[model samples]
Target: MNTFFHIWKYPILLALLTMFGLLAALIGTGVWHVLSWITLTIPAIVCIRFGMFPKNK
Candidate 1:
């Protein structure tokens, strides 16, 4: 786990941040309205699974 984070932390952070930023920036536009919430499920689930809970050792 430590090794993984040490090597991929930056890239993971960048990718997730970019995805979230793009998602947030589209709010209110026509396409945004179209995908407005459907696309949100990915990040929402990611956060819930990783950010909110971790498996026991």
Candidate 2:
């Protein structure tokens, strides 16, 4: 339902960005590999989601 997507937006956006970064890295673009590596980790996104937006009850 709608609720699920709202709760999982972070994971979804992370996955999409990860895919884009990987593709950019594979294409041999400068600086993309560095960004790709960053997106692949969890720490980068943890604060972005929970820190900025506390979940509502």
The candidate that achieves the highest lDDT relative to the unseen native structure: 2
lDDT of 2 by residue, 1-57 (tens): 699998988778877877877686898766877877776655466768778998786
lDDT of candidate 1? 0.64
Residues 3-45, model 1: lDDT tens digits: 9888988567656755765676465677665554555565666
* Regions more than 4 Å wrong, model 1: 28-57
Q: What C-alpha lDDT do the candidate models reach, one value each?
A: 0.64, 0.75
Q: Per-candidate TM vs. native? A: 0.42, 0.51
Clashing pairs in 1: none
Cα deviation in Å at residue 39, candidate 1?
18
Q: Pick the candidate with the highest TM-score.
A: 2
